[model samples]
Target chain A: MSTERGLFDLTCADFGLIRGITESWDHLLSRSIAAVREQFIEQCGLIAQAEALPRIAGRILGLMVFDGKDYSFSEIAEELQISRGSVSSSVSLLTAMGVIERTAKPGDRQDYFRLSEDPYTTFFARARNRAERAHKTIQETRDAVPKDKREIRSRLKEYETFYATLIKALDSGT
Target chain B: MSTERGLFDLTCADFGLIRGITESWDHLLSRSIAAVREQFIEQCGLIAQAEALPRIAGRILGLMVFDGKDYSFSEIAEELQISRGSVSSSVSLLTAMGVIERTAKPGDRQDYFRLSEDPYTTFFARARNRAERAHKTIQETRDAVPKDKREIRSRLKEYETFYATLIKALDSGT
Candidate 1:
């Protein structure tokens, strides 16, 4: 009788502590909201949108980040109303970008995906890098063309200089 | 012998007058390449790259100002290497943007386009108006969403703020 009572008492104490921990965790809870962001894990959806990922990727990011738990590929596809192929491609890109991570359940052959701690850092940096690379290629094109060809090359060089100048100016401010 | 002497006398007088004119107009002739004062007219290309129309529209202003010539739609499309459909759209947009104008050629069915002499003033004013219109729409979107769904609304607000801030910064820059 005493052991049964002790177990009951212990269970009740654990439940009470759980409630207290949640009640005192305003900062931690707000991380899931917009306030206490640790490198903006919460804004995964917004970051994904600016990255020009397909709608499938947006839902995948949203579910993985906001759904409070990791999800398997098939499960996410069903949730997002996308095909498994779409889910695979979206998650693959997100995983490669380090925005989403993959894990496997014990004894389960299939892997699951979840959001990373710093989604926006990858989002902005990768996007900037891609644009900068294209900018470089365009500059190369401008240079490879000969001079004095009816001023076409001159115009290309001028535009390339302008873009390089503008992006730098914007970067300096931001 | 008298006829030959008469021809020689006439040639000498013509040469003296030609030398006088050359000496007087030497400065202008020195500045003129090919010894001709060929005017570079800035014509807006009727057809433009659709994907690049907006950015190209701005560059067209620079192109006209720099090259001092009017470019036909086909010429612009060929130079830019974009489809005629795209150039068509861009020229239309630029016309609407009021940065360029269409000129009619007598007996020519196809219209020629050129940069407006007053480009900067109108483009700046129009861009400001566009920013104001965007701000109003953003404000409306914010108001339309429920306050409790702050996460979604706040992200959108941040995007709007970024664009608004960008416009302000650009407008302030020379």
Candidate 2:
């Protein structure tokens, strides 16, 4: 009976050690994951700001794009540390921009949002269109100016040419 | 004698009319040119803000790129309607970023600023490097996470793949 008691004690000690190891592993893993998510959100903010999108909207879209998963409105707001109302409006705006879309989960009343199939392609296409229009506007202005305003006319021509080159570059693709 | 005087008066009146038309044309041309410059500056501000650049610096760079000429510090300040101190710091920052360079004109004491030889190419190259670093960081995190966390690991993998595709796309030119 004494020998049996010793075996039982050893078994309990080993199990507790294993549990401790697992718990520590989980803690470290969660910390690292949080860091990655934070970094990703920041990157998305930078790109979105560059593209002239609002910060919160960019963050929501960024989270969806990187995670590639559908999120409920509350989930996104909580994850991003933003107000629920802000998330609601930003998601709506992103949906309208074709950067993200809403889907309903079966048997669940909460709406879910996910990135569009090809957000970057759509964004770049819009940028190309804007450049083309700017080029046309510059061309018209150049034509309207008199010949003697050589310096100003030359500047407009350069802009027209640069935009033309840029559009051509964009069209060629990678 | 009377006929000669009348003819002279008619000639003078015609000459004055021609001068007035020329001056009016010049006035309209300058105003339109100013408008174009203002619009271009505004566009640059938008793109710069999107890219996390200082707005004034972006405007100055945009002016140089479109005009394809060097400008003195005062000229840039005056043209953009910004303070000289802002222009000074913005130009310095842009020069450090490799988007613009300082040039000296023969016989002119003041420094001039102009766009770098290929600003867009340089800018895209920097962007590619940043993407590569992000991919590596994500890869490390993905490896560190436990296999049971399939959702988190999968998100990191997707990000890795997307950045790889983006760098490839950026590398393919323009």
Candidate number with greatest TM-score: 2
| Interface RMSD of predicted model 2 | 4.7
Any runs in candidate 2 off by more than 4 Å, and if so which? A1-47, A62-69, A106-108, A126-141, A144-158, A168-174, B1-34, B65-69, B106-108, B126-141, B147-155
Q: How does each model score on lDDT?
A: 0.55, 0.73
- Which candidate achieves the best lDDT against the true structure? 2
A118-168: candidate 2 lDDT, tens digit per residue: 655555566577767767766766776668878768766765776676666
Q: What are the per-residue Cα lDDT tens digits for candidate 1 across B1-174? A: 354664346676788998888876663333343222111111122112212235556445545544546778777777666688877887887788676788777886776788665444453354355546545545544454456877656654654675476566445533
DockQ of 2: 0.21
lDDT of 1 by residue, A1-174 (tens): 354654346676788998888866743343244332222322334434433456557556555543446788788877656788888888888888886799889988888877676553454344345436545644544444444554655554554554465455345435
Clashes of each: 18, 3
Q: TM-score of chain B only, all predictions?
A: 0.46, 0.72
Candidate 1 lDDT for residue B136: 56
Write down the TM-score for model 1: 0.48
What is candidate 2's TM-score for chain B alone? 0.72
Residue by residue across B21-127, what tens digits does model 2's lDDT show? 98787655654656656666677776666556788876886688557788998898888898989988999988888888999999999999887766656656665
Model 2 reproduces a share of the real contacts of 0.21
- What's the DockQ for every one of the candidates? 0.03, 0.21
